[model samples]
Target: MTQQPIISLRDVGVRYKRAGSIFRKTQYYQALKSINLDIYPGETLGILGRNGAGKSTLLKVISGILKPDSGEIINRGASVSLLALQAGFDPNLSGRDNAVLSGMLQGYSRKEIESKLEEIQDFSELGDFFYEPVRTYSSGMRTRLGFSVSTTISPDVLLIDEVLSVGDKEFRKKAEQVIIQKIQSQQTIILVSHSEQQIIRLCERSIIL
Candidate 1:
């Protein structure tokens, strides 16, 4: 029996407008055009492209952060989360607080978030810094905390956008291992990456934007 798609997108297109100076007319760019895709349950799909090729834009649309300018998206009622570097965090909040906030934003209850706090803290390996304001954190520390929180929540549809490159070598290895485990457990994922090797290793199928 064939598997059903958890999300379906047809004739999708996204456009952006650049404001014009007094001397020039406004210009518009099409970020994505005539895109059609079906994301099946429990499949890892890699989206590959260079900078400004709409890979991130496509993920945002699927995650419901952006609406396509000219097409229909049918999400089969799956909960979705996007894990982009520095995307969902508040700089003034501590890592622990951010983790709680992130979980809540992903549809978890406050009690559930509180219960997972310890696990998220341990997985992030942020130590005492987990209680410190995120603004004081280095980029790598923020990445670790963000990755831990997002993975812990385990949304039905996870969207990752160029976040694998955020941390140090050791942390990157750990993050990659976690993602591999998720794939092994048959979690559905849409990954946007500029790294060709990473895509080939983690994805069963892929498309270039």
Candidate 2:
């Protein structure tokens, strides 16, 4: 039997207007144009594109963070999560508090999030810095916290946007291992990356935007 798509997008398009001063006219750009795609259960799809190619835009649309100006999206009521550096973080909150908040946003109870706090803390490896406010964190520290919190909850559909590009070699290896395990467990994923090798290795089907 053939598997059905968990999410369907048809004739999708997004538009953006460039910032302009009073003397300059604003120009509009089509971020995505007449795109049609379907994301199936337990399938890993890779999206390859250069800068400004709407790769991140596409993922954001699917994750419900951005609304397309045109076309329709049909999601089969699956829990969706987007894993992007600094995407869902608050600069005023500490790493620990942010983890709890992110979990709550993912539909987990506060009690459950608290129970997983230690695991999130350990994986992030922020140590005492985890207690400090996010404003005190470096870019790498923020990435670690965001990644750890997002991965703690296994969503039905996960969208990853260039998050692997951050962190040190050791952390990147650990992150790749985690992704490998998720793939082994047949988790549905949509990954946007500029690395063609990564796309080839992790995805059975891919598209270039």
Candidate 3:
């Protein structure tokens, strides 16, 4: 029998209005137009597009952070998480606290999130910096924590938007290895990347925008 889709996008469209020049009227830009897709379980899918082609927009839509201007998203009880850098973190909170918060937002209780804290801390390799406020973190540090939390939570559907290249070489390698293990374990993933080669290497199927 055929597998059922964990998430489905039906005739979805997202538009934004941009300010125009002094003489020109404001214009509406369609970030995503009439999108129709079925994201099945345990499949690694790649979205390939140029910088302005809405790859990030699609991930945001799928992650429910952005509502489409038109059509419907049907999520059949699947948990989706975007491995977004510096996302869902409170600048005033410590990275350790933020990790707990991020997990709770994804439906875990405090105890559950706390139980995984040590693994998250070890994987991030933040050392003492993990207890520092997020506002003190550099981009690399943020990436490390974000990646660690996202991976540890183990959401049913993972959305990765070009995050593998944000860290130092060693950290990047480690992050890639974690993703590889998830892939091997049949995790459902939606990856958006500018590098076609990377997409081809990681994804079972891909679509070009």
Candidate 4:
């Protein structure tokens, strides 16, 4: 039997209202237009485009972080974990606290986060930094913590933005390993990245949006 399509989008479009200059009273930016896609289980769909190509907007729609102005997104089966580093984070909280908070926001209980806490801490390699307030962390440190906590508990679908580039080489390697394992395990993945080599390595099919 054919694997079910875990994600479906038909004629989807997202328009953002922009404050226009004096010459132009108002306008709308069309982020995604007439996009049609079907993402099945066990697929890694690479999305490629230029800087203003609406990659992030498309991802947000699929991950339920944003709603499209037109058309429909039918998501069936699978818990989604989004790799938007700055998202789901509280700056006032320590890295460790933020990890558990983020997990709870994603429907994982405190007990579940407790069970995976050590692994998240280890993978982040933040050491004493994990105990420090998030505001004290550099962008790389924050990204590492976010990446580890987000991926430690496998979700059925993963959405990754270019935030992976924010970390160090060692962290990048760890992230790649986690991604490889997720793909091999038949978890659906959608990603946006500047590295075509990484995309080619992980994804079997691609869409230019």
Query: Number of clashing pairs, model 3?
Result: 0
- Candidate 1, residue 127: Cα displacement in angstroms equals 2.0
| Candidate 1, 64-168: lDDT as tens digits | 999999999999999888874444699999998999888877778999989999998898999999999999999888888988887776788888887777689
- Model 2 poorest ten-residue lDDT run: 79-88
- lDDT (Cα, 0-100) at 58 in candidate 1: 93
**Cα deviation of 17 in candidate 3 (Å)?**
2.5
Candidate 3 structure quality by residue, lDDT tens digits, 1-209: 19999999999999988878889999999999999999999999999999999999999999999999999999999988887555578989999999999877766799999999999999998999999998999988888898888777678998998988878999999999998898888889999999999999999999887
What is the alpha-carbon lDDT for the whole of candidate 4?
0.84
Task: For candidate 2, write residues 39-127 as lDDT tens digits.
Answer: 99999999999999999889889989899999988899987878744445788999988988888877689999899999989999999
lDDT of 2 at 12: 98
Better of 3 and 4 by TM-score: 4
Q: What order do you get sorting by lDDT, best first? A: 3, 1, 2, 4
Instruction: Write down the RMSD of candidate 2 (Cα, Å).
Output: 2.4
Per-residue C-alpha lDDT of model 4 across residues 133-191, encoded as one tens digit per residue:
99999988888888888786567888888755667888788788887888788778888
Predictions in order: lDDT: 0.88, 0.87, 0.90, 0.84
Off by more than 4 A, model 1:
20-25
Best by lDDT: 3
Which RMSD values do the candidates have, in order? 2.0, 2.4, 2.6, 2.4
Model 2 alpha-carbon drift over 4 Å, by segment? 19-26, 86-93, 134-138
Q: Model 2, 26: alpha-carbon shift in Å?
A: 5.6
